[model samples]
Target chain A: MHVPTPHTPLPRRPFDRSSFVLSATLAILAVLTIYGFTTFDTNGVDMDMALDMLGDNAKTLFFAPGLSNVTIEGLLKNLGVTVALGFLTTVLGAVIGMVFALASALNLAPVWLSVVVKAFTAVVRAIPTVLWVLIFAVSAGLGSVAAVLGMTFHSAGYLIKAYAESFEEVDAGSIEALKASGADWWQVVGQVFIPSSRAALMSWTFLRFEINFSTAIAMGAAAGAGGIGFDMFMASGFYLNLREMGAFTYAILIFAVLLEYVATKLHTKTMQG
Target chain B: MTILHVDNVRKTYGGNSYALDGVSFSVEKGEFVAIIGPSGAGKSTLLRCVNRLIFVTSGEVSVNGIAVTGLSNPSLRRLRRTIGMIFQHYNLVNRLTVLENVLHGRLGYKSTIAGTCGFYTASEKNRAYEILHAVGLHEHIYKRCDQLSGGQKQRVGIARALIQDPTLMLCDEPIASLDPSAAKIVMDTLRDINTRLGITVVANLHQVHVARDYATRIIGVNNGRVIYDGLPKDLTIDIIQKIYGSEAHDLILADGDTHGTH
Candidate 1:
């Protein structure tokens, strides 16, 4: 028996250094340009006035003995209202958004229906959440309902797009098998598409809830709903109390942490199963 | 006793090459026929056309003497209920239980409201159980589909087709994905069903020995057309060489060998 010798390796090409140098130089120049534009100062008088107000508010808060108790109570009440608004708006948005998403998914609906739904979602998302809140406040009057509707509209737009993408990612083979087995169109959607993507849909819904929570806070301030943002505005204008403002700010932070924890738990549990 | 008739069936995709080129054949009731051919030789397209899964470009397919090509969507769906199809991948809903997947075969018979509510009648449930038992999967009915082995999953697929109680069964490479032992089991099960229930069966298969073992009639396809149709014993080496051309020797196996070990 004869043994064969291994072949020698071919020469490797040298690395090109010019592309890296050019990319790094361009990135640094872009950063410098953005920094120079943003730092250009035109509001010196406005800055001075804001500093004066903050100093006065701090002085008052330091002198007040009962400030801590009042701030705590206010923070709790504001947090409760914010959570309630977020929950209500998210539920409404999810129901309507799921319908639109299903209608738009290519695997589920006709071509014309999918196109119409995509256009509708695009238009809805184009309007800012703050603008919706302002419009509702002006037309429907200042209240929690206006704030909730504004948040729901924006959330529905975002969720419809996300849910539709998720629905499209479902296995095409399962759907084809269902259709070939004499299943009706609706049957194919319910049994095949829904079950395959249930975990992904749940994760997307939880993610939307976190976004909607923050949106509710901002919309509440714009629409005069009784939430933490409203308390922050009132404390700034009427009492000028630094402790109250700090407490409300801290409350927003706490809410964000709680929502993050819940979302993480949900994602982990779903993946485990 | 003719159960299915295909008259000049032709299927052309993208207006260029034909998947099936003007092929015509009839299946008698209770007969077990196997379509053996090379890959992309129109075996699957011909099988799909029988159930109207893929629309025939220029032909008519009649099931139980009723014309299926000209039927509307609703009528076509109704016609499909009488025909059962099996796939190479098994195609069971992975997230659903084996029993529920089998029960899906009754979607054509169930009302829209009933299907939406996830309700199946008592007799239908019993029939599903009976079919599962017949396929030797009764003990695994409540298990999720992904939990089963390859052979077991294919058995569940067969059970699902059986629950339809179809007049004709169309199987597209039903045993191509299994090991030798498992493939033998599935083939034997199909043969047993054909003998007992007397339901007409048309299967697409790649193995010549498998076709000879289970099928009474064998049809050879090459380049989108049927080149041979006769008894299994009459399919000599010369005809095999013509059908497969360059790789004809690979198609031959020992006669009456079921386990694929010979």
Candidate 2:
């Protein structure tokens, strides 16, 4: 009679936590280096000019309370255009990005198609938003359309990459089940994949809005599109409108904070879901 | 009448190791056949080939005498509507309600426009509810699939498959992920479906005892080849040993005394 020997156990490998720490440190250093290079400027500082501007702004601001009596309609009209431009560019970019992202997702596309889409997205994302804005401003002859087009192009590039990653991370088994049930490709996408990724997609959309809003402000400044950013540039150029420049700068900061708060809330809700 | 015929099918991934090698089998109109094998034995591949989920490299597969391999997309979609499948993982869209998941089974029958608009007829919705009740998940119809237990989710999967009103049901390790009692329940449910609906079932099972108990016929596969194909009673220690190799003893259930080999 032959007795069967017990199976040999595989050797255990110890976990190494150093790789995680090293990668994180490298990432932080990379960010710091990029920031340092971008902000590096070797120039003389003028303390007297800065003090004069601040003092003049403080004096004008103290007396400018009565300026609120000027037409409220003008302010409202300016705000309407800014809000519309921001919202429209963000929505258009999100919709177009979502379409391309779905086409590019590795799980949805054939290997060759996925490769083509990834290459296309990489090229699109390599061009910075500010550069796109400058090109559009010069080519399109400087208006709201230029700002909108620039924001849409740049935001679409970033959003397409993010959305593709989200789609790729959807549960493979769910999609396989839908296919096995004989659902057509579109039905599987619409029913299972879209529903499962709804929270992530919505969160991404909100985050994109925040990014697009800032881009819209900057693009408006570059293209001379009459938003808060354009107003800031004009005030800074005039040299006498220090109070207006301060107010516009404050407005931009407030807008950024508000949008960031909304984005954070949306992210929290998506994670909770 | 033969409901499905897989004729000398071959599948080779990367043109070397055979996932399925010249495998041939047939299912009668209402026969329940269980396929038993170890891991990587081409059991799942064979079932997927029936529905063309993974295309076969060569050979022919037909459902109800209609050839499936060469059919166009629309024709294949029509053919798949008639053959329901259940998976070991249940594979329910975790975010969707149980009712919605069941109703998805009707996508093949609905027109593309109607499916996109989600305009299911009242009768179809009624049928979905009826199947949900049949699978004993009527109360959980409104709940998301992820919240359900494994056994309950498998029941919903059964309901979803049943809603397709398929003539032939293919299950790939339907109870492999379940506890022993849950596995029994799932097997009993499949057996009941086969008997009551007169639907042909081709299931891949890991447990030999469950295969013997539920299957009218047992087919044993080893290394992408069908080594034995016969009635459940004919499955012997020698055949099990040949199919499972060194792991043959693992296939034997603790309460396998009924087969008279203890």
Candidate 3:
């Protein structure tokens, strides 16, 4: 072994508090897991039959899936509806969120306003997207309108935090330069802040869009919002057609991959530009 | 004529101690005044105060014969349009193209709607291109600022400042971050601009010899106050000691030889 500092002894690391705590936690979890399985809670259960059914279900749902109950045209229309739901809510949320983000950023706004905006957005973010949708469902009556409003509300909360942090990460020198040039507040925001943080803003917005797309599908079934999620729910629950459910899942997966590809390309383009 | 004046300026960062204590100076038009000081000697603060970038705790900073303190937002902005500022870090928006960043100097003269929408007229663009060419950045105008070298970036900063058609330019440690070679280029460019364009230049500099070489007048600051203000030839060894304190020994030794022209 080639030791550069051969005269000096290699210092040995002392056992630290965090390592002890981590080991203790793992030991406790291991004991609890073993104890849980050894307690013999399987009473009157047929293991063989359960395992067989699991294998059969997996094979039926994934291996031999086909669209028997629904036509490709119907599936495509529902997919379009879901895509529209996500896109609309994301666009609306991003527009409004940018305003709030600028207000919340310390460099861009007054301290009092930034604090207030941050506190309000924090509360909004603490609530889950589904709960917000349900809350709006009470007023808007559990339709596409409620879904749109709820998703947009949650997305704005999420994006305000993301966008504000990105804006705050901008170089202080750049901000000072713009201010020194006698640029007004809006001028600084539009020219320097927006252009400087465009790539980050786009990256965050795309992440939110992906989240919204998935949530829109979930909202379709839960809130009776019309989309492909409702079709999946009907096929699985009312129709008990696992093959149709598989077809819908494949369609969603393809769309998601395409969305991600587009996002990555745009992100690179912005970063280069 | 006096193009810039600082009258009895005092600044404190919400503390009992002063960052700038009763400092005063005046600059004639077309003069290149270099302010040399140790770190934390409030050189940057004094430069910023002239533009009202950092408001002084108590002082009168007048530029182009207009008082800079206590003006309304609109009037303050109007006052700022006639003055340009350069920074040590260049401070060009990295993601923006060189042309776009240079044109930013016109933001002060534009309407809010026009500036926000980036609606620059043909003349404004032509002036930007002309300034870029003068700075030797015409070849890289369409390239993003982040792609440029430090020397190139600083030139872009100068072009941005010049496009304002400013009567005065404030440079805070303009070449402090550059190498010796690049520093020479920046200093030469500043001298040329002062002599040719007749714009008053006030720059905060860390190098004593550089100040002596380029400035028509040198202001030496120590402990947030002006200790020496005279022609560069009159800045004797005793004055350097008074301005730099114990740090003067190394400076005098290291600066014994003339700087390389390269």
DockQ scores of the candidates: 0.52, 0.56, 0.77
Q: Is the docking of candidate 2 incorrect, acceptable, medium or high quality?
A: medium
Error of 3 at A236 (Å): 1.5
Write model 3 residue lDDT over A16-61, tens digit each, in one string.
9999999999999999999998996777888789899989988888
Candidate 2 ranges beyond 4 A from true positions: A1-73, A264-273, B253-262
Pairs with steric clashes in candidate 1: none
Q: Which ten residues in a row have the lowest lDDT in candidate 3 chain A?
A: A2-11
Order the numbered candidates by lDDT, best leading.
3, 1, 2
Query: Per-residue alpha-carbon lDDT of model 2 for A95-211, expressed as tens digits?
Result: 998898888899988888878978987987898877777788888877876777887887788888888888998988778777777788888878877888888888887787877
Give the runs in model 3 whose Cα sits over 4 Å from its true position.
Answer: A1-23, B256-262
Best by DockQ: 3
True lDDT of residue A46, candidate 1: 85
For candidate 2, the per-residue lDDT at B1 reads: 99
Error of 1 at A267 (Å): 2.8
Q: Estimate each model's TM-score.
A: 0.86, 0.87, 0.95
